[model samples]
Target: MPITRWIRGAKLSFARLPIRGGAPSEPAYIYRDPWKGDAEQGARIVSGRFLFERQEYSFPSGRWDQGTWPEPAQEWLHSFCWLRDLRALGSDEARLTARALVSHWLSYPPTDLLVKNASVTGARLAAWIANHEFALASADRRIQQKFMERLLQEGRTIAAFLPLPAQGWKGLKALKGLLAVALAIPEQTGFMSRFLRYLPAEIERLILADGMVAERSPEAQFQAARELTEMSIMFRTAHSSVPPILETSLDKVCPVLRAMRHGDGALAVFNGSRELYSSVIDEVLAQGARQKLLAPSMSQGLFTRLALGKALLIMDNGPPAAEGFDKRAHAGTLSFEFSYQRHRLFVNCGSAEVGAWNKALRASPAHTVLVADGLSSSDFNAEGRVVRRPAHVMCEHQTDGTAHWLETSHDGYYPPLGLKWTRNLYLGGEGEDLRGQEIVEGERATPFALRFHIHPDVTVIRDDEDIILKVGGMVWRFRQKGGQINLENDIYVARGRVEKTQQIVVESIQYKISSEDNKLQESDEASSKDSLSENKEKKKFSQTVTWLLERIPE
Candidate 1:
């Protein structure tokens, strides 16, 4: 290690020695975890099978952190949120199991750099503080003091770090932990005041003006809400007023997150988001302020919502998030999801927590959008920052209270294939009709494919040129004029695991825009010759594919 690194490490180690400054040993509050955990997970943990981040490990008793393990599973173990699962089991044996694991962890504290990661440490500290009753209330006095001392040390460490970079939502988790410590133990006057000092600017930098996260993810939005809600609960537990700025930030975010949900109560799978349990989402929403639904059509946050009767749709209309926040961003520009009532019909394959699945799902092919020559509309470099994304995305939304329609265009393919992509979507017929038109304007014949990923719960069948989907009592048809349609095997990973599903892919059709196609329409002919709009319209030559979804009268 360099001298600087050694000195920094020495300072951090010195900082951990028995938190002093004459504060009381006991905390003022121990708040319960607001979210529930899986009883199945609790059983698996007790059985010595550790399942996390889509990887499973079977270890002998009490040696979870000792053996060779997947990196993510190790992080999960050290972060210590698994206590929720044991607490959910709600048995004396379960509590003792937790106590044993926690006690061993506190004593031996894993000696890896990842274990000391600020976010990991923050989360572990918060978990230890929040669930002390179940984890160690009856443990020996020395063990209890050691736990508090660790909490105090980690609390001050992250409080000093303040805003973390490249950690979008995970950074908030760290802050959530810091806030938990500050409020739970009133004696750490410095920790409480320091937390209040740096909060507003951090929230402003992370959250955008319109309530969406800077990362442009529905999952991030939901997680950020959970963090803020816990902080609010912490304030209430401490008998202090929730900071006005904190409440304001929460209010801005909840409505936008609520509007992103499909007809199903969970969030729509966009960016790095997945379908979190709807019950938990409802629980999170119920605790804070009432979130009024956003407008059926909007440009802010660039995710448009349209609903008529039971049919609802969310479309991504913006480019990938600007650089620093684009780590979890996807390249599915102009893709949309559709659902009816509580059932999803079309979706983008949802994202995962980690591993190859997440990387594979980030490309444009995993979404319901057009791909030119199998290239992503946006792609990440080795560092995972977005590069080669659509340069200027234009979306025009229109509605008349009874119908919703939008026109979107992007230059994502223009640079590589000399083609520009435009899509038009219309929803009408009291939630029964959905029409889409895909137009590509290019110099020569270009091959492209359009994909629509169907939900695993929806059954699909092909009948000649028309396609059919059935879920519950509702039946819908998909018909297109583009090219051959094939139903291929796929998988849905957004519900936090993988399940067999299928996708409808319209194979590459060679399309060319001819001179006649660029001729002026009669409406343009009537306009004055000096009109700039007329000249622009004359250059718009394109090959178009139109499709529709309508209910087959049951």
Candidate 2:
């Protein structure tokens, strides 16, 4: 929030650093012209013209007192605008900005640092390292020295920054990679080599077995990937191969990355990040392509090309990855993300915007499941407290050509109510229709709940036989034999400004079971007795409803 305020009022500009003029250089193999134009064209415009243009600063100074200057505000304003301007102008201007920015950044001492400020600084420094092959190859020695020194200072700050033990793993990995690059810099070899030795253990602890980062949010995963990819590029440019673990880690991660993408080029924004960066995925994919690594196909819109060579299926078998140092992971477990033929299905609820009011909005019901009792998993509370350990069990899953089946029997939810829920999902083989069943296996009959956060354009209708969902004129029906309820007409869950009212509906039905009797008269009595028992059971747990849903159509 403070950073957001700082960004609004800052004066930032970039001037293109001179490139030794010659025959125009051939574009690098990995380089694709950005949407606006090649980086150079944009750079020239910003450096020669835009830098002189004045603009109003909406960012706050956070300087309540007159004596002390808002150092963080200044650093953020310059760094944020510098990065934006670099992208607009080209790597030449970016290099120039990086050089000047680093020099200014290093002039300050480490004790006066802000965590977010350091994080962004690391990202920009890493970006410079990535583009070094093209932009910095013929740079001035003074600029290079200043760049290296600034990067080292960032590394030290990151290393010293107190990160929460559980979630800081990804940030730590990123910090380590950045530091490794700084160490590889000619002047910082001794210090960096010693720093680099500790990275392997750190990476092993942070990265999960399935290539998912410790913090499971797609946004965090993407950010970590961007940072890692940049570091790897820098290492390769320095003539050093990447660490073997990173190479192996990325292989497992690519599918999940692919799975998290929607049919649109945008990622399924979940957790706390919704601001789409310019060509973030494109840069990563370009790097991956040049390295001969298989990357996901991504497009910007409905009719854009959908890369299908890489198909992925992701299941949330555990609670959100531990939020060690990062606060972006969500609380949804037993959920899934699937991508095939350029179509994505069943994504985590996209992220909320960052700031104060948006804090509770992050826990919006539409973003996740709100069972009749509580959350789907008990690993963490809304305040992010780890109340219970995640249950360990074999989650049986099988996928055939037509449908996928998932069965999770975990004790994680049993402690609160002596209840065990085995959730089974049958997704149509073609990935169109889905049917789910939650069997409560416990001494007492408990309420079973399922919530669906529909996309904005979706339309929902509750019918006697089924619940029908219409998206873009396509109708999909979910049929239930017993009875149906519409909770949207009943409950109110706090969704943000996007929807005036978030609708949630609940439905229930009853079934009758009877057996043939030896005689007709005896059969009548047996039926009556069975009816009495059923009535008593229903009365005992009248609150146990069958259906609860929160939906948004595509």
Candidate 3:
């Protein structure tokens, strides 16, 4: 490792050493937890178990520190959510449970490395600071002092080991924790200026200009926005002027975040995103920071959106998240999700919490895209690391008259299958008619399959060469040419559970061109037009698939 990295590691390691001596001061300011809590969930925690992400796990009562917990549960433990949830109950039982758990963990601090995660540490520090008033409200002086000592130790450790460059979400979260510490106690006041200086730079680095997280997860984007909002409140409460960058970041982010939503108000599950409940989106936008400007057709985000009339289509036109950020990136390049008014029509299989299902859900076949050779466009290893990815991708959007056109192509298949895929989408002026053209170019014959995952609410009816999708009062006809269509069973992972769903698959059709047309040609516009005519003897084979979706009148 480089000296700089080694030094950072050493500093972090040194900071984790138990500090028995320290005093915890009551926070001068407390920022509200933007995410609402559930008292029922808090009841479960008091029972010595955690029900997180719809997955439940139990630990022996009062022996919580003796065993390793399942994920989400483990992460939840480190997140200090018991304290946050305790506020929801505001009951004696909840307070006792919270005190017991905090005392247990503080007494027998887990050796698990996840406890030291930058984001978790930051989040826990902030959570403790925000709920200190309640957690330290105990009449017992010993209990209060122990809680304060733990908070001071955690805050000091987090300050010493704040995430470095390339930390992505983890670094931003660490900054939030440091800022919390700075706002809470008088001794850590210096962190305020440093946090203010780093806040803008971190936002600019992690949040793209189009207001998407660099990781490209809609869920992650929302988390960043929420933290930034809380930070803004913290600064205001501390009588420190909010930074212009903080406000400006929210301005750019809120609208794009809004655009990513479906009519149902849930976020699109593109890259490792899960559908979160509550009117959180409304709460974020209600601050008046959101601009009501029309959504852009293409963003720096992995998804490209085109809203025409009552129809909204979000297409994945960008590559997977970069290497370090690929933990949550899905191999669904060129996949898409579509919604009309209040109903979702076409959708990608939302992300899962964990296990084999989660890995399978991230594959290309689980999305609305063409899967070549039964493999994902971007391959992944057993550990969810991206083993392969597209080398180049090109996407463009144009408007002609009242019609909107979006064209995108990727070379993800070129490396293994020697095939290139391009898709063109045209939305009619009234958004009643949607047309698409898919072209595959390759040197040799290769089996290809086009998949279109549908939302569970949409029912499909076969009509010979056409497929009709009915959702309540609306109807959409899916027609295709030159490929066989089949409806296959699928799964939709969303809102914390998987539901049985269906997908439309179009099998590949082979086509061949004469040797005269086989040679690679220049990309000049003039040559491209005449190239077809130049190969007169070329017995043209259908190398394209055309499909259309037209709204049927009531």
List model 1 lDDT by residue over 156-241, tens digit each: 66765554555676776777778777766667777777677777767887787788888788888888888888788778876889
Per-residue lDDT tens digits for candidate 2, residues 254-294, read: 55555455555456545444424436666665654334333
Give candidate 2's total backbone clashes: 32
Identify the runs in model 3 with alpha carbons over 4 angstroms from their true place. 17-21, 60-72, 163-165, 288-298, 514-542
Cα displacement (angstroms), candidate 1, residue 57, comes to 2.1
Q: Over the stretch 332-412, how does candidate 3's per-residue lDDT look in tens digits?
A: 898888888878888888887566777888888888898887988998877666889998988888877578898999999
Worst 10 residues of 2 by lDDT: 297-306
Residue 327 CA error for candidate 1 (Å)? Answer: 2.5
The lDDT-based order of candidates, best leading, equals 1, 3, 2
Return the top candidate by lDDT: 1
Report the CA-based lDDT of candidate 2 relative to the real structure: 0.45
TM-score for each candidate, following the candidate numbering = 0.90, 0.63, 0.90
lDDT of each: 0.79, 0.45, 0.75
Winner on lDDT (2 vs 3):
3
Runs off by more than 4 Å, candidate 1: 1-14, 17-24, 58-71, 291-298, 516-541
